[model samples]
Target: MTNWLLRASAAGLYFFSAFSFAADDSHEQFKQAERIAWSGNYEAFQQAVAGLDHPLKPYVEMAFYKRHPRLRYETEIDHFLTIYEHTPLEWPVRDSWLSYLKRHNKKARFINYYRDTSDAELKCTYLTYQLDLGALKKPILEQVADLWTVGKSQPKACDRLFSMWSKAGYRTPELVWQRVTNAAQRGQTSLLDYLAKLLPKKEAYLAELYQEVRRDPSSAAGLYRFKQRSAKESEIAVYGVRRLIWRDPELALKAWQKMQAMFTFSKQQKDSVAYRFALALASKGHEEARFWLNKVPHERQDAKLLQWLMSNMLKEQDWEGIAVLFTGRDNLSHGQKYWLAYSYAKRGELDKANTLWREVAVERDYYGFLAAARVGVPIALNSEPLQVPQTLLNKVSQAPGFKRAKALYELERYTDARREWNYLTNTSSDDEKLAASVLAAELDWYDSTIFTLAQIGAWDYVDLRFPMAFKDLFIRYSERNRVDLAWSIAIARRESSFAPDARSSADAYGLMQLLPSTAAYVNNRNKVSKKRLFQPATNIRLGTNYLEYLKRKNEGNEILATASYNAGYHRIKRWLPDEAMPAELWIELIPYTETRDYVKNVMAYRQVYHTKLGRDGNILAAVLDMKIAK
Candidate 1:
């Protein structure tokens, strides 16, 4: 056995298998050792994993620690955690090891091993450990109060800590009111009631009023009762008004008008109310939207407010309004610059518009493409390939974390693989991240490649950012559905980044992110099962066919079809203008920010894919040629 181990070690074999010494066979043995560890056979688990030099050896050791969990293995646990500090292996083992130390009353070791955590029990124990060591400082007491003042009841382990903090006068009436407000906001009624008892008899009534206003924001109409104009009173009124605005904007406006007359609201408070009220009014298409929006100074208008105002202006063809909104603003985003240039052109300031368009066209985004088309400039890809040193690339690829990530990916444990990959990228330097993206691309893990580049803001690496994945599938489906090939590929890329196993929180599945219902609706003649929806061919085919259906339904307009694909056809009908508009104008007026951005990205990505596919496509020609009818 010793001689055999020597030969296997010399040959770089990770595990010995009876069947064969292939990589797959070694993986199987590693898996088998994990199962044996779970079965509580420590000696057999050890022997099974013996001579293993694979990247997954740490995982096997973690499994053994779970089953054994003896303090005698502390040295090995420390070594595992130190070697795998940023990887997923560190947390579970460290958590369990801390628990073991806590249970054994090993306070010194616990303090040594403890890292900052949000776990209330661990935090309480950590503070208690400090208190036992004569740490009654204001900072320690303050941390104890932070844990104590939360809305919900903490674990029983916090009881002793709370007693100490209260004795130290850290739990004052002011802190009690703060907790009361938190509990009320979080709808922890019982906790709020308990906290109210901690206040003086006169101020306790404020807690009852808070509960009343929380339960029925309409109670804010009785503004006369709040005569003190205290900070707490203002908080209650603002909370009620904010909640009320979402329910009934007009009523919220009336209540705020009355509250402002009675209370001394600061400028920030007034602006906060104005911002929410403006958004609510604009979203509901209230006539008073413009009035409320103007109440907010231009400096305070964020992207959402700007988008809403721009949508309204585009609908009204108020080019001067759009121009005025962006004029003299040096900090405009690319989209804002495009709109500003369009406004200038519409209002006959051709020189200014052309100059701005020239600047905007240099970018590689939706607005950049549109600006380029407007000014008749060549659309720039701005491709700067990520160039990493061969030595660094080789070193990164051979890192233990990268090796384990690749191994997990090869074993089809994608979730685990993605976790490991994310950890690797998050902790790597910029060059290391670029190199990691190259490694991910080589492994055909396009999602990680795209996300890592995005994380490092390496947008000029267009090839890495927009990989040509599943080219044949996209082409075949595009032809089958009579859809534009680049368009279909762009949609899939935007939806899933070509991760076939992608599933969204909305239960959207696979490469195209099709909700099962939509897939069934499109393929009513032959239902594609949920399982097949994840397959690249089926997802592309179904998604493209659905896009085609939307196109034909929208009078063969691809822009409308793309919008309907994201925001539903029913919403598209509601959003349609009574008068005909340019397709770009109509697209800008889309109410849902998500749908609007989706359309813009899809259009831009389609153009990028077109160039990537070696086609002589003009990005501007596509946008300028389209029009939407009433």
Candidate 2:
């Protein structure tokens, strides 16, 4: 209760500690009202907010509208919107008003209050309203056509609109056929049968044949048996080739050879089919990948294709192949340049490798550390101090969004506070952003502190970006579990941004995001009886112990332990290579996108947190040069 009511009083002092008690009490009252409002006690909420003279008064007024029976109060809703018009409050109020109108079928009022928004369901509803009012037929029909052409089914709100258009004859046979084709291409085959009923007889027969070829991609050989070919046949061939290639590239390649002789596909379709099939082979580490690679024209190579090609070469240690593949390419990234230099060194070209390493050694990333180690140069991942202006700080402290954010922060609504903070940061100047970052840090808002500082894209203010908040708790737990303090900090930052009550959709609780079952098991095993796991000290204690257990189980590999923590231990064990490899490449090959990103970020953040703790941040010694345990 104190944490909730004290934030508003504290932030008031944060901006101006010299204010009188009456001003401070009003702020505290609004904070109390916010809590009551969310508790669904309308009478108590109203009484608490009555006669409040604080910056949060607007939020208090809006809270009355929030708790009010929504559709029963249109006049009041309109009055609310008019009072808050052209402000942030107006948009949220309008969104609520629009939802009320949508529920009550108030068509004219819905359109009258509508604002341009990106919500798919809202846009669909608006279009439905336009159709209901008997507006211009051509515009409405065009939108209908656009919606019907999508591969996946839309929200249930869109079904009525689609049914109306279909019944009114706007859904022609050609249009339905086109939609069926689009559905098949995007792998939404469940939509095909319903779409087939709308097509002409001959095209409907073709749709069945398309589905057959699609269901069993290996049956693509049957496509060549047709005496005549059309655009439909061409599409089916490409679809079959794309799907079958992943299953068996050898079979797909044979089908492609026959497809070339048929001359059914256009040049662009042919290029795409060839590029996809080749990479499918390369990703599987098949030697036949080279055959398909030779067939693809240089212009057809995309970023993903090039990455898989390089990954395959690196897997085989084909250094000459890598050199031949990337020589004289001017768009190489820092990581690519380092790998290219490594390839040159592997091929016994020391002079060429050293020249490239000199440039790569200056980067502030993982490869830079590796390159620095190679060249005996100092790592360039050094922090710089922020140069903020005083005037910008003053201006930001007065911004409306900041006031709302401070208000919400006091109420323990971190999610709502973050929304206001984002609104402020989007339109802020660089110095104002720096000031906001500092303010977030002062408020113990670790997530916003980390995010806002990163938005500035300046690395010098390491202290502000990576504050060692909860130092005694984190240090005590880390030492007890025999875990590195930097690693503990990194996990805490990535897991919850140090939001002690943070939760995920998976039902994980607290800063370390431990699942309920995991927390219970840890408690039972450790003979601890703390019921509230959200407290910072207890969460850190359990999280550090769990991470340490994972580290030992993975043979002292931080990469593997972090990966297992994100993706389960059993799943990570299945991902290990046959032999030891560089942790960098090992991380890239991780199949789970979420786990892969988690590992890299935790490792990188460990370096940042280490540097913030005034330790020598050696990236090479930390991760790059070491082997990820198999």
Score residue 389 of candidate 2 by CA lDDT: 53
RMSD of 2: 5.5
Cα displacement (angstroms), candidate 1, residue 120, comes to: 2.1
The C-alpha lDDT values of all candidates are 0.82, 0.75
**Please, what are the lDDT tens digits per residue for candidate 2 over residues 1-630?**
123124534555344232223545666787777677667676776677776667677787676666553665677678878876755667666776787788889998888878767566777788889889988766776677877777777788888888888787888867877888877666676688777777766566666667777778887767544445767777777888788999977788888888878856788898888788777877666788766765688887766666766777787788988887888787887767877988998889888998999898887665676677777787775656554454555567777788778767776777777778888888787778888876666667777877887887866566666667688899999999999999898898889888887888987878888886777666665444334667788888888988998999888877788998899889999888888888777776675557766887787678767766768746555455767655
Question: Largest lDDT belongs to which candidate?
Answer: 1
| lDDT of candidate 1 over 232-296, digit per residue (tens) | 89989998898788787778889998898778888888888888888877876777888877888
Q: Model 1, which residues run further than 4 Å from truth? A: 1-22, 132-139, 208-219, 222-229, 523-533
Error of 1 at 573 (Å): 2.1
TM-score of 2: 0.81
